[model samples]
Target: RKQLLAREMGLEPPATVELQESDKEIDPLQVSVLSVSSFIAQMRTVVGDGEATESARAQAARQLVRLAEAGVPGADPEQWWATQTVAEERPLNNKPRLSPSRIEALLKCPLNAMLKDTADNNSDKYHLVRGNLAHAYMEALGRGADEELARRETVEAFEKIQTSPTWKRAQERDEFEQLLVRTNQWIQETRGVLELVDVEVRVDVESEPGVRITGYMDRLERAVGEGGEEGGLRVIDLKTGSSKPSDEETSAHPQLMAYQLVLAHGELQQEGGLTKVVSSSQGEERDGATLVYPGTDTKKIGTADQARKGDEELAEFAALLPPLLDELAGPRVTARISPECDRCPLKPICPVQAEGKVTTDVNA
Candidate 1:
């Protein structure tokens, strides 16, 4: 009908298209567009053929299985097989380090966490850039940078970052500047509570032998008691996003809990160079952990019981790591689809998503 209409409009009929034969040679890149299952099915034919040698057939079958298990789009089965084989044979003396954020990510979806480590999909979205700038400004303030210098440096740093290709398309430049101003104002307003401010301090605690939990504390403050004695340690995490603390989120807040555990174990003071300052103030206990959202009326403070619960949860998670690592090291790793799949970069090729098992609403 479209051809007839075109002819009536004084145009020649479109040329008839010829379909390529199914057995015709195809570009390797084009073959990458095939679904993992379809590709595996095709590979199976070669593996089952009597003409192929036993060793060659076995190798092809192994490659097919690896590709199916990877569940990532456009991943080269042969390359993945070779790389995984080499990695499997390597001596893994170095223990895997778990940060609070990484722990949270793993809990949401193990496959997502694994892909985050291996994928090169780093983002410089508005929120991420603003958060980073906020952190830098807070770090400078904590490190004793005069308010004026800190403000100037933060703006300069952000300006330099704006020139980079990573942030070339960053939106909301004015909003980011306002955020900096508000952050500086917050620093000034909270100076009384932030008597001893340590910024970007590295805290490492070995939950168990050969298993370590490591992270950087954005701000660690030494609070003063009513009687002028050392009150205790306060771990404050800055947030630039819209997420507020809820009973559910705070109850299992891995980051805050990790900070509490580190402080409870006295590792934050001992290993993080806080011993001198902390000891000088007579070695006070942990007061609590707070998530501070500057420029917003949102502050989530975890109770003492919540912090202790976090310690227990961390231990339990550590105990489960060996088995989880063993499973991931094997040829096949199961994907447990959840609401998190909506944001997962691998969802495009995820077998579970392909099968329509993923939920659409993250809140649901």
Candidate 2:
């Protein structure tokens, strides 16, 4: 800096003054001045090291205590939290109405499923906000609101929340416009088959005598096949996340199957389930479900995954839920470690994985 200043002033930099470039490698063993905190921390490390002698560790421990007694910055007793007795975790006793999403979570990890509502879910709220707002906007559009009206109405609703993470109203509004464009383009290019009828429709049905299933369907659409032949009602599930489910997963998606179960069994028979929602019902069964993905990629506005619906398949999937939920609701919930474990935020308090997974084990 001195040399640079001298050169800037047009005086030749002194030959004795030299500054090492920032890119130069630093010597690891080079001694440097230590702050009181750093020195105390080093002493602590020495005290804790297994290789350190008993006498040396004892001396270091004494020094730490002495520092704590003194008004030292590092060795404060108040820093250590008082440990409390942890409550014993038990499985849920009462049966929960298995929502489509909840079923999916339980299928992955019942422990996760059980704790999500209670735990401090550190999942990305930004994406969640965007997803919710997008849904509202899409719903508004589906219900015959114009583009601008939908965007405005969505923002007005979002702004009503008293507490939320910081994402500007203007930014959300702009993104709503982008979502509107992408979803429209996506519908034209990929999701042209199903026409949107209902948005955010709830399906609550006691499929079995004891067990119940429920979820909010993103949209209920009538499938328009070749020659404009109106097919059965198709469940339209919108996914606003960065990653969409694989083709295979989408085909056998439990959530869609669950929704279709309600559809197939005529649980949603009120208000003319098929005829009222769409004029041309033809009294046909649910054809299938479509999972729409509005891509982050602008050039490709549309991406989708389809799940075929059959009464037998839907029935079979529905049958599996009661036993699974019953097992999960009990004390013996199994933690099925899968790819999602890598992204799960509950690891620190997770009953199974709180002590950390084997870092070196290939199978783990």
| Superposed model 1: Cα runs more than 4 Å off | 1-93, 117-129, 163-171, 268-284, 295-334, 355-364
| RMSD, one per candidate, in order | 12.1, 12.6
Model 2 misplaced stretches (Cα beyond 4 Å): 1-93, 120-123, 155-176, 187-192, 270-284, 354-364
Report the lDDT tens digits of candidate 2 across residue range 1-364. 3354345334456676344797356666433335786667666665778996676677667777888998787676354322223234576677657777778888888776776556544345555776787788777776778877776676666665424446666664556566667776665554567766677776766666766666678888778897788877787777775476677887788777776766755433446443222112232377777776674645675455455566677767877887666765676666667788777766655545744333212233
Clashing pairs in 2: none
Per TM-score, the best of the predicted structures is 2
Model 1 scores worst on lDDT over the 10 consecutive residues at 275-284
Residues 11-130 of candidate 1 have per-residue lDDT tens digits of 456776665797466667435334665655445555667996676566666666666577645335444322333335543433456665566666666667776445434453534665
lDDT on C-alpha atoms for all candidate structures: 0.59, 0.65
The alpha-carbon lDDT assigned to residue 114 of candidate 1 equals 72
